[model samples]
Target: MAALPRQQHPDLLVGLETADDAGVYRLTPEIALIQTVDFFTPIVNDPYLFGQIAAANALSDVYAMGGKPLTAMNILCVSLKMVAKETLQAILTGGMDKIHEAGALLVGGHSVEDPELKYGLSVTGIVHPDRVLANSGARMGDALILTKPLGTGILATASKGRLATPEMEAGMAEVMRTLNRIPEDILIAGHIHAATDITGFGFFGHALEMARGSQVTMTLFASRIPILAAAREFALMGLIPAGSFANRRFCERHLQTAPGIDPLILDLLSDAQTNGGLLLAAAPQAAQGIVTRFQEEGCPAAALVGEITAPGKGIIRVEA
Candidate 1:
């Protein structure tokens, strides 16, 4: 993507420059369009649930950009000869349900036959031109709040290996299918400086992007990060995903960990998440309140996990 010629225009609010969650283009003086697309092969056994998770994950990019999704189109890839007709219908139905839940219309879509089944959406949303949120605006003294727990990658690996308990599977499914929609009242009250959804990059990977983009160092309290209880056990059992290791390697040079920090915790931090929560950098004074409201609104795992410290070249410092 870096090799592609950079498109410069007066209305391009957010582009490929910062690797933000979505592309924003100003349509008018008051409104801007947020566009993003994501699709992946099955991560769960149930086709319906997989569809819901994929749609939610794709829609999350718009939400992370502080936009409200207005419409979505299905992106499907499957082998018609190999997949059952009922299964395909279930997947489409599931995606439609989530799109409606987000108050967005599913107007149309395109599909193709492939060796593997894949599903997701192409979402278009709108936001105030002045209020577009990008991953590059985090300021020093801002509190980092994560809206969901970590460890989905490890749990999924354990499930694939048949080592995960039923409870663990259920927990992982719930986290993946849940949407990261922040209420309007909280958005207005939180004074968010920057935001991004935790997805394929893992928590540390995305946070590193924010730190680098804002040109500041981030200090994380390892103990404060929320993790699914079973993830630690699975990670210790060596059920970590290959993506987790790659994410760690990608961020290691810029990462600084304090002595005595648990290796298992670091593994969990680097675990690649599917359809994870929104990580918001908010004003310090209102950070706790925003978290409280998130908890009250059914996001029980939401917590303040870190903060921007000082000017730096995208370095992350983790403490026990």
Candidate 2:
């Protein structure tokens, strides 16, 4: 963004300015390729589970933008001397299963030897230019909706060294492995104005980006935020992760905190989500319908977390 060097092609429509879910390069006035690639090291210990989480996280970008994933190429970095082939196979199997579940074809994939294990997908999805969802269109009075409970990052951190409890691990794993497909159908049906998937950036970080990108402010109600019960209980026990701190730092300037609510709640909001759900800004009337639709689609964690407000006041306000 510093300077669009000379050879850069000018885009007639929106693309990178909004910190969108994915990069849209228009092929024509009618169609655009929504491309996104996200890869990371194992978040969980089980190779198979790690792969599933990674695949779900990677494909979420396309879904967030109201695009259906059509095809994908597997990306793998394996440590040949460091791990057994069986472990790698489990990882691949996990990813393949998720890709199939998403209705996206895993036509081919690439694997290379490396010092650390990494796996994800480089996905391509198709969408009509006119039907694409964007983050810049969020309006005042729009109710903010979150489709998944927060705090996956906290559990994952505790999951390391067997520090995580059975209930805690089960809850985070369940949410992280769950796909955000429920919201995609909602987006395609039209009415959703702005949307973004939560990942390493945490909810507040991404919400701030949407607000700043749209030149608006978001007022979040802490009491109503749908967070896994374990997230709060464990957070008080100092089960916070390194990424949580990073997330807090990233959104600290744009966030407004209140007392009586333990500071641990911020840790929950800033918790680095792996394959977190969608945070949508849409008309107030649509909020209840969207939440209900998500419940019908098996995402009971979805809820109306807050509302978008006017600009210059603040990007986010976390109630007491």
Best by TM-score: 1
Q: Model-by-model lDDT, in order? A: 0.91, 0.82
Q: Best candidate, lDDT-wise?
A: 1
lDDT of 1 by residue, 1-320 (tens): 99999999999999988899999999999999999999999999888888899999999999999999999999999999999999999899989999998999999999998998899999999988888878888998999999999999999999999998888898998899888887888666649989999988899999999998889999999999999999999899899999999999898889899999987777899999999888899999989998987888767999999999999999999998
Could you estimate the TM-score for every candidate?
0.98, 0.92
- Residues forming the 10-long window of minimal summed lDDT in candidate 2: 5-14
Per-residue lDDT tens digits for candidate 2, residues 7-72, read 335442455555687877677887878888888898877798888888888888988877888898
Where is model 2 more than 4 Å wrong at Cα? 1-14, 182-185
The global Cα lDDT (0 to 1) of model 1 is 0.91
Q: Tell how far residue 195 is off in model 1, in angstroms.
A: 0.4
- In order of listing, the candidates' clash counts read 0, 0
